[model samples]
Target chain A: MAAKKRKKSTAAENEIINLTNVCKAYSTGAPALKDVNLRINRGEFVFIVGDSGSGKSTLIKLLLRELTITSGYINVMGYDLSKIKHRKIPKFRRNLGVVFQDFRLLKDRNVYENVAFAQRIIQKSNKEIKRNVPSILSVVGLAGKYKAKPRQLSGGEQQRVALARALVNQPTVLLADEPTGNLDPKNSWEIMKLLEQINENGTTVIVVTHNREIVNAMQKRVVTLKKGVIISDEEKGGYIDED
Target chain B: MRISSFFYTLKQGFRNLFRNKWFTLASIATISACLFLFGLFYAIVTNFAHIVKTAQEGVAVSVFFDDGLEESRMQEIGELILKRPEVSDVRFVSAEEAWESFKAEYLGDYADGFTENPLADSAHYEVYLNDVSMQSALVTYLESLDGVRMVNRSEIVATTLTGVNALIAYVSVGIIIILFAVSVFLISNTVMIGISVRKEEINIMKYIGATDFFVRSPFVIEGILIGLIGASIPLGVIYGMYNVVMDYVTTRFTMLSTLLSFLTVDEVFRVLIPVSLGIGVGIGFLGSVATVRRHLRV
Candidate 1:
């Protein structure tokens, strides 16, 4: 019995994110998410696919603690989001890296400064920043472009810079929300490959995207949301046709 | 709060000030204008009060003894007058000295006609008071004492000086309060604009797990720098202006100096410098804190 209990605890430890029957309702509108049950294990790469106005964005926001769950429980990397204090939110967020659709790079700063920003926020030592930022930039295939500004870079290079920034802090989970929304097909594939490489190196990657081609081609776990409800979740699944 | 982060926040704060140069200039100008008016008022009121104090010190109450009073009894009256808390000093004049002074003033050059002393009963005690407003009370107390025949005081001068002092105090307090409020409002608005301009940057910082202190420190620093510069400029300006005005008043109106003395620039700045800097920094800090609390929820 003791051995079984220990195994159960280990399983719980491996589940990095757990959401049970989560529901979110905004003021003066229908519920954004309804009775959602999702569990993302450690080092898992999952894609959240949905049409516009679906609950995919809502789920991502909920996980980021940007929006409060209306009803249900959310536990991310050992923190109960519902019970977390506002002051602790920043500390909690440090454990997760986030990339936005617009590739939110600091336009005024150079690529190195932009990536170093995250490290600075965490108060990393200057020596650590000097070491880690270049290493991550190199990983994202932008080592030579450290001094380049966001305006001087192509869309792909800018997204790469944003990716380098997100990974520079070595967060446990990388949450990419439509990361390739504005990129061309070749650039999108490049970003997807980088996300894949990041996942293979043992970081959990959750991608929320509407690109059907990439979604179908990658053949990863796909969770589809329709009208604020999870209609389908499949392993080795492609984008389900919305009829 | 590592030393590295501390330096970074300081650097960011200075960078932010330069980033929003126009807004920073506006804030500094607002603070400078407010402090300049404050310093000007302060100099004027302090000088006015100093003049009143000098005049009050000179306006003595005359106390006369009853006729034929014993020498010991007169001495006792002088000691009693000296014991009063309101009395700063007491001097007893002999009848002969009083007669000499009266004759010297009124009978100058024609004095040989009146060899007999007409002012024999004019021996009196001159009681100087610490505050002019307390003159009436001291006079009343002096009148109640034995061996005192009369107590004479300048009632109109005392009342006028006391009224002017009271008016200066009230006006100073009212104006300082109004100016403080105006300065804080102007600084808060400037900080609000800075926040709006950096709204996107702040949001990104928040997402990147920047603590509230980390995010807010730069703006607070910006406000402090603006206040510091604002306060410093006025001190220099006021210093120059005060000297110019003092020189102009003393040289231009030579007769006024004999009656009323102006404070030296050093003396005025000894009080004004710290007070102005404190207000400037305080307004900046309070303005930034209030703006951040209301607008930068992160």
Candidate 2:
């Protein structure tokens, strides 16, 4: 069964996500992540910056519970990552939202249906889905394009549809990995602005990206990685390419 | 899971059943044909067994008396046979009575066409045994009797029929097993195609926290529909065709009907219905579950 929807959890001031000395090593290669320690409290906007192979994707994967850590502890929303049952991983994932670079929308489904799918997975009633889908679409500026298929929409609109899908559940933490990678500069700024608004509304947001200009402009707390280890963590830090 | 979720998966499965028209049709066609052949073989094998069983039931030995024996002597012989431990029933039929029964049963109006009763040496003790396996020993004892001229028994016919029945059953089972395996493989491949068609959607679903059961339900539902439709076609066809053939054989081919009786379609489907439906649905579920499990390991 799906887990219960989470409460705000802000009153207790609990850390929403925690990773301590985490390590992930594949059999054929060196460690993808080494001794990574990080923590984020409620309603903070953070960015994870790294070059290719610097383990940004690996960190995102670890937080999503898609990859088992080789060692050390990771916890999110009071559930230990190592102790969570395999069948309950999906229930754990519902506490957070996820977005991707390519905007993974079901091509056969329209914008509204795409966003509503997340609710349907948790077995929401038709009445509830009806009430929630339109409101979420309005949040992502897709209220009038509910019937448009993925191929029929522009790239940014498709990403918006994906964002709507991710946010429809009102997740406590929003994890966006290269969300604006496929968009032009103007579209990228709009997506960043939306993420900023979402963070302001008492939700923790974590963005992983390679876009240096957008990172410098946002001046968010940035955790930079090099050679499978954290080199710097700072509040209001800009993306320094040379590390 | 909620009731609404159950309905959603069911409706999803129904809609997906028609998603790829050609693939669904092909799978159903193959399944129906396989099931039809299975039903046909079942009829033939069961009828063969029925005929063998009846022939075994009717097995008996006849003890005939000498031509010069007095009626009193024949009566003593009949009494002796009646006293035997193996004999279940012993009834004496005289030459005249035996001839009359023969003419009435085998000759019909053709007996009137004949002026004389042609069967002269038909008198005997029609002895039924408690067990067919004791027939040989009884025949030996009767042959050694004083007034007995001959012993007539259908042991050879019964033995041959029983053996043939066993052979038919073995061969039919072997064929059915091979055909069933092939049918299941074809069903698995069909579901595999459906999974491949929606790989991207499936990946997205998994990432968004759709459980394995939810992700797999639609395909399973489609599999069940295919199985249901596939089995019903052959069941209907075989039942109707069996009745037609049974009517023709029982009416027009009287001689063959006596020796080789076929099962009524109703009788055959008593076994066929469960077997066919089980095969259809079992394969469908197995295929879908296996494909989904392997494809969406996350």
Candidate 3:
């Protein structure tokens, strides 16, 4: 008989997320994720590695409450995602930072205002904005580019600004969806390193990527999805299967 | 949610209003022209009503007694007409006094050639009416009396005035409705254009957790500003036009001066300024709703 896998208890260190048999289906028949489960301990740097259309992006969207799971349980920051009210979505979002592949920065605003916008939504004090914005910009290597427009900056610089905005709120978890998808190889590595630095400071980092080079290089706990099923989840993983 | 945040929307609206200056001015011009026509029609209707009242006051019905009636019968008929509550006052004019007054006025031209006074020896009871509408009823009752030969009133003039009044009212109300519709359309469209142009910015505000009220308040306030500016132009024009019209009517139509007291400048201003503000505020509210509904999808 197969050994019974006991559910890991998260009540010890206050787990940030716990998912069990999470399944999502867009249509009546086909499933996006089939009988999948995930557990993320607090302050963990985890990478969701999969090929294109392997449901890695779907997992991030479900975690962020941007999309709903068809059937199964998802708990994020100790709140049930399925039971979250519509009005409470903003409050929930304020607690988590989401980075888009497309870099969803407001084109009309400058670098300073773009980062300041995140703090504005959370209703932070002027003194806090005055204090945190410069520090966050400096961390993202954009210290002196406060007045620069998004279009005026390089693609890499623009992504840094996006990261800075995500970091300014000091969220519980930072979800970066293909954070380096548009960057050059050098810029991509630089951004991954920045994410590593952010994770060291006590924020749970979830990076979704198909980049084999960066995935293998980071050597963090890798959860690999193959055809909507987690075929391999290891303590430490590599880019190619070591079969 | 806070007062400071509401100010932010207002500032955004004003900024947009200035940015889209041509569209704003076009809407204001449309609103001013419509309001001006409304004010002009209002002033005309008011003056027309004054004319009607003057005409009604001047045209009195005279109840004439028969020549052969006794003085006691004539006096009894006079007393009967006077007893009706609708009758304001009754004055008895004897036939001798009537002829004497006629001779004094027209004798120089033709009275010397007449052998005897052609005027009948009849009692003329000049009846004042408290209600103008009761003139026909009073005439019918007087004609049925024992000594009254005829109750002559200006029926032609009354009928004509009634027709003119109906025409004035129909035209005034029609014009007012048309102007109101056009003005409201202009205001709503102005706001619609404004919302469409800033739709992206508005969407970001929604995504970033701005409340519906915070996103909406600025457009409403902007509508109000547009309304106020639009209304001011017509208000000044209306006030100035009233003065010019008043002077013209008083100087030329001298007969009207004694019977009809024209509206004072202050009275015109009092009624018009409120109407202007009301239009401004009402349209502003409607325009704001139009804008917010279109742009602030959240």
| Candidate of highest lDDT | 1
Instruction: Tell me the docking grade of candidate 2.
Output: medium
True contacts kept of each: 0.74, 0.63, 0.14
Q: Ten-residue segment with the worst summed lDDT in candidate 2 chain A? A: A1-10
What are the candidates' interface root-mean-square deviations? 1.3, 1.3, 3.2
- Candidate 2 residue-wise lDDT, B115-228, digit = tens: 665656668888987656667788888999998999998977656755676787789879878977877676666767766776777788888889888999998888888888
What DockQ would candidate 2 receive versus the native complex?
Answer: 0.58
- Tens digits of lDDT, candidate 3, B190-283: 6666676667666655555555665676667777787788888888888887888778978999887776777677866777788877887677
Runs of candidate 1 exceeding 4 Å displacement: A1-7, B114-116, B294-297
Candidate 1, residue A195: Cα displacement in angstroms equals 1.0
- Global lDDT of each model? 0.89, 0.85, 0.78
Candidate 3, pairs of clashing residues: none
Better TM-score candidate (1, 3)? 1
Where's the lowest-lDDT run of ten residues in candidate 3 chain A? A1-10
**What is the clash tally of candidate 1?**
0
Q: Which stretches of candidate 3 lie over 4 Å from their true place?
A: A1-13, A17-41, A46-75, A81-83, A106-108, A149-151, A207-213, A220-243, B1-13, B19-153, B168-192, B233-269, B293-298
lDDT of 3 by residue, A56-165 (tens): 88888788776788888999987798898766767777778877777778776799988987876666766788899999999999999999999999988999998999
Rank ordering of all candidates by DockQ, starting from the highest? 1, 2, 3
Please identify which of the two predictions, 2 or 3, would achieve the higher TM-score against the true structure: 2
* Pairs clashing within candidate 1: none
Per-residue lDDT tens digits for candidate 1, residues B104-155, read 8887878778767888899998888888888888888888999889988889
